[model samples]
Target: MKDLLIGVDIGGTTIKHGIITKEGTLIDKWEIDTDITNHGENVPYDIWNSIKTRLTDLQIGYDRLIGIGVGAPGFIDPISGVVAIAVNIGWHDFNLKEILENLSNLPVYIDNDANIAALGENWKGSGQLVSNMLAVTLGTGVGGGIIANGQILTGTNGTGAEIGHMTVIPENGYHCNCGRTGCLETIASATGFVRVAKQWIEEGKADSLKVRLQEQGNLSTKDIFEIARSGDESTNQLIEYILDHLGLALANLAVTLNPAKIVIGGGVSKAGEQLSKPLQKSFDKYALPRAKEACEIVIADLGNDAGIFGGAFLALQKS
Candidate 1:
């Protein structure tokens, strides 16, 4: 029988799983809404059942399955398969690997979602060229993973590349979900853009976005981008705010890590060069000369499937 691998990406609101061949093609996959309200203790069983049902539906025998690789949102101990903490998922000191191994009777591997995303990019997507690169994901919040010499640099406590929580501006900025002020995510993330825009709209600033949001119901970060494209004054200002912070953050990372490249992924990156242009300009100005010369920042080649491919890479390595 041909060998198969299982890759899971767990998020705050959904759990995405996929089956893949050794070549990194996603053969089949599905997503389930995560009910974190039940607390983190219940996540493993839910994941186990989900996988079991999928396997049964595919009619794949257990012997052909090699191993399972999981990417979850939290500080994970990859060696022990324990999640030290996940504020969004409500998990603390949870034994994820043990539960999955016991349920499926298969070997399991786990790591933070950002690390897995970087692995995904490295395996079949953007980072294939360079050995040292940083993958920064601009999701609901910012998540990052650092890779050096084709291996994840998860630092002590498996939480090294917590770039989102890094302080960009020292004394003045909004509070982040991680209980810090002036975090990169507080200004650069999807939620942050909307927060800044909504406040401006509520203040009755004159712009097309206010009219658009009033008609389109709830305003998303994407909506802000759309309005900016159409020449909305307030929307343009919001994009400027985001680009300034995002560029400054990248410059800071560039100076410190000096990675060969910076691969940007996640939903907000969909803005493409509209976002990248200003960000690149800012990096050119702010980053050190050698650091800027050493690195090339690019959009992630893989779209939503980076996580799946990354997870499959993890599984295949184990097999």
Candidate 2:
């Protein structure tokens, strides 16, 4: 029997799992609600149970599975498989690997969710062609992962590529969830996009978006991009504002890390070229010429599947 790999991506609201072959083919995928209640104490058991049930349904014995890899949102101690903190999921210094292994009786590997996503992209997605790459996720917040010389550069504490928390605006910047001011996430994430648009409306900038905001009570990053695509000058300016900061952040990463490709993912990337075109312009303006020439900004292809694929890759490596 061919050995199978199990990949698990644990999010705030849901847990995604995949059954993959050693050669990187996804055989099956499914999801389950994350029971974050009680400090997420049941999450590990839930995952173990789900995997066991799936294996039973497939009539595959436990020995046929090579290992399990988990991508979780938090500051994880990759070597120890312990999550130091995960505010969204209410995990604190949790020994995730030990618990999951106890239940599945298989070797388990775990890492930060963003890091795993980067690995997934590096292994099979947009960054696959490059030896050095970065994956930046722009969602409610910004998350980043770095691949250096074909390896995940997880820092000593597994928090190395935390690009979102990098301070971009030291003066009069909005507060970040990390209890800091002026993080890149403050101005470049989907929430930041909406915050800027609302600020413009409050400052008496009248445009088509004002009517939409008044009607909808809120605007998504998508809504802003759609307005910009239709030649709305004010919305276009808003997009430029967002891209300016995003570009600056990415350029800094480019000059520092000299990654061959920077793959953009998450909800905000759905803006597509509306985000990339202006973003590339800003990046080129700020990046060192040599670094800028070496790196290309591209969108992620795997979407949500990146994490699962990355998890499976990790399992395959460790097994």
Candidate 3:
């Protein structure tokens, strides 16, 4: 019926693909491992080929497709359709739009992963109907997407609302992948949480976390939260520090954007209310009273599918 859209979200290890209705209903979805063996030079061809095979297997005619939308992690230039850099995916100056368009002979659009996620959440998840909203993802690294006056704000070079790179700690902070020191990502991300916990253990501030780390040979944000629940004062303190910095960063964004909702997603958010309650306490400490009172913090409902929905939204809007 020409009412279907193809949505592709490229991650470091997996590439997620979806067929969604024009109204944002995901009809079918699947994932494929990312082949990064050769600097990702063959990734584009693989993605397009996979989509065609899936369509044939599903008995869907090419006439039913309208366009394709893609979301990836990087400094995406939506205007140029070139991914300037995606460290995790090994794509630099990748002309994503032209390749997809030429291969499929269909309209293709792309945006930053976080930005598409924000659009998806606002359109169908917790931030629905809000013209002003913010979506923050706390995973291996932090990601931010901002919506203002009903439009996604992709400023010049598509770096707008990149809260992860914000300099929350100006001195002696852990190094970020972006080559900066003391970024919020070095404090609020899962990687950041582990780094801080390791530092605390070395400083004799945490005993349970150190023991757990040794037993497991590694640590995660989940482990930290679990330990805190078991009455480990050190782990609790570490959680507080991470959340407090996350809160402070969100607060600064809240005061500036004055968004009606702040939707938190990603791996750390899996902790749920255990993460939100204390985070709200820390946010109230720094946010302006009006901003704090106006914004409602909530968890994302769509989980990982946000990107697929968001990618469909991009196709609907741009093509």
Candidate 4:
């Protein structure tokens, strides 16, 4: 019988799972809404039940299944598969591995979502040629994963490559949800872009964004990017700020890690060259010439499926 690996990605709102062969071909995929508010403490159990129910629904025998891999949002212990902390999910010191193993009777592996996404990209996405690369996800908050020499590089304490939290300003800047000030996420994330745009409107700037906001009642990140594409001055300025911050952050990573390519994938990255063009230029400005020359900042090839595909691949690799 062929070994089958199960991969699960636990996000703030959803849990995505995929079953795959050892060679990385996806065989099945499914997702469930994550009840972070009520069941935050039992993330592992929820994750296990999700997979068990999905596999059972598919009529796959437990004996034919191999190990499981999970990608979660938080500080994760790669060695022990414990979720140390996740601000959004309200989980701390979670022994995810023990709980999942008990629930499913399968060997399980878990890591931060960004790291597994990077592994997935390296295995099947845009970073195929590059041995060293970084994966940055621009969702509600910016998340990053660093892979070096074909291995996921989680530093001591399993908190390495938190690119979003890197400081872009020193004092008197917008505060981050992580209780910090001047984090890059404050300037570059989806929330940060809207925050800056709202301030512009408050400053009496004229733009289509105000009209859109008034009509739509709320501004999503996609709305802002779309408005910016129309050459709205206020929104354009905000995009410039986001690009600068993102570029500076990428430059710092380039100098430090010397990765051959930086792969960007997220809801924000879908903006395409509307984002990458300015971002590439900004990276050139902030990064050292040699580092800039050595690295290529490119958009992430994978879409929403990256998490599921990467999660599945991580499980297969571990097994």
Candidate 5:
């Protein structure tokens, strides 16, 4: 009979959900395959059905639920709960909050997936103790979130923290999905990491990665980092190049927002100190002296759950 919250994180492949207490305790979690067919028309229905089933199984009445919070990809108008577009999910000008609220008769709050992850980290993960922090996710692409004075900055058009699109190499830079070249995403994301490694190898920069790439016919950021860890000079240099761009982008963000902690997450972050050590060195070099002295960079602690936790926090705030 305790008040509970539902957190939903919508991704390209799956939808992750969690039942959490008002106090930020995650009680249960589950996931459902994302049904992006038919322009994602069934997404809201699927989420509602899943939540009802879970609540029934737990003997929790609908009246005990305070609200629902959703973290979705793409541009979102948090004030209106309308998703302008989510290419991955095929949503265009979708009123996600209204759809879910009409279906479940519950108040709903929504925001960008990365922003919610930042909120989750600030509330219960690595940034728990910091009131202001920046959360960066380095996966197939780069995503970022900014928290200032304990609130997510959703800027005009909800694109404020789209840090991936920040141009790092204005000249002769790789093309980004945003239809631009030289974005930080082009050089620092997992895809970018592999692209650079492949390009370097193709240019005849012989290294241990060349053999691995020849054997596997492809390489992941993990594979590159593993080779670098083995002291492959060429691979190490590639990592340094990647971190240099990433560090510069982060440092620029630091000077602008002056966050107390920078929490990094996502698949690429699994490289650990192999990534963080050099990343910090580069950050220190580019960041303002005062900002450099005040901030610390750390890895995300909650992993995939950060989004769900963040969703719950949003629901709690609205309730």
Candidate 6:
């Protein structure tokens, strides 16, 4: 009986894998470093090989597998399973489903990374059972997935709910990975925040945070948050700037969608209250009274595993 499912979450640095049941229970999970070498030409094979090794070790027969689901960064054509562009993963017009299907000989499905995270959160995380919700991921880059009327909103080209690409700065903004300028991702993402911090320090804002950042070469979001909590004026100010933009963008989306819950996920969200409180305040500042009152902001319960669960959810839909 084909009762098992495979969930794969592809990121720039890592690829998370999971074994799931059709009922959405996570059976087991693991991860591997993403090999972005040669435009990630070996990624598909690597994934299949790892799955094969795991299955062999677990003594799970191939017949027990139902299908595979994938969550990848960047633009995707879910219907055709073509990755239009995942710059971080070095894939362009890549036939992800085809390659995986050819390798694993199982059915495959794919969606934007953020969309799956939203689905996962809706299914088993903080946003569970919510009919209307928004899921945002703050990582190396910001990504969003919108749920309206209990359905993931994939625009005509399957690019709906792309909150990160929204233009926050019309001019003189940092360049975005999406070939745009002043995107919310450039301000709200960890990369963006660090970039701005470094720029500020280099531009003559002498501070303890600057010294720490310089000493560490690249600082994690947790490090930055810790410093902010310690009352590092520069770090706190940068956090404020980022939350302001994030809040404003989420506020606009909130009014338009009237979602009941806005779920925060991804690595950066690990800062917990330190990040959420000010973000909520910023959100309240920009959101309509009714919308703000109606919505509840919550941290994602799944942490990094949200994507894996989301992939499972996608596969279960087909199963």
Q: RMSD for each model, in Å, please?
A: 2.2, 1.1, 1.2, 1.9, 0.9, 2.1
Model 5 regions lying over 4 Å from their true place: none
Off by over 4 Å in 3: none
Misplaced by over 4 Å in model 4 are 37-42
Q: How does model 1 score by TM-score?
A: 0.91
Best by lDDT: 5
Per-residue lDDT value at 84 in model 1? 93
Write the residue-wise lDDT of candidate 4 on 1-319 in tens digits. Answer: 6478887888888888888877778888877878777548666677777777877788988888778888888999998988899877888888888888888888888889999888888777888847899899887888899988877899998889888899998888789987999998887887888887787778877467788889988887799888888888777777887799889889988999999999988888989998899899899999999989889878887677677767767777677
lDDT of each: 0.85, 0.91, 0.90, 0.83, 0.93, 0.89
- Tens-digit lDDT track for model 3 on 256-308? 99999999999999999989998989999999999999999999998999888
Clash number by candidate, in order? 1, 0, 0, 1, 0, 0
Q: List candidate 1 stretches off by more than 4 Å.
A: 199-206, 213-217
Residue 153 alpha-carbon offset, candidate 4, angstroms: 1.4
Compared with the true structure, the alpha-carbon lDDT of candidate 6 equals 0.89
What is residue 258's positional error in candidate 6, in angstroms? 1.5
User: Would you give me the overall lDDT of model 3?
Assistant: 0.90
How well is each residue in 55-133 modelled by candidate 2, as lDDT tens digits?
8898888777889989999899999999999998899999999999889888999999998999888888988748899
Q: After superposition, how far is residue 88 of candidate 4 from its true place, in Å?
A: 3.0
Q: Model 4: which ten-residue window has the lowest total lDDT?
A: 37-46
Query: Which pairs of residues have clashing backbones in candidate 2?
Result: none
Give the winner by TM-score.
Answer: 5
**Which residue pairs in candidate 1 have backbone atoms (N, alpha carbon, C) closer than 3 angstroms, thus clashing?**
120-310
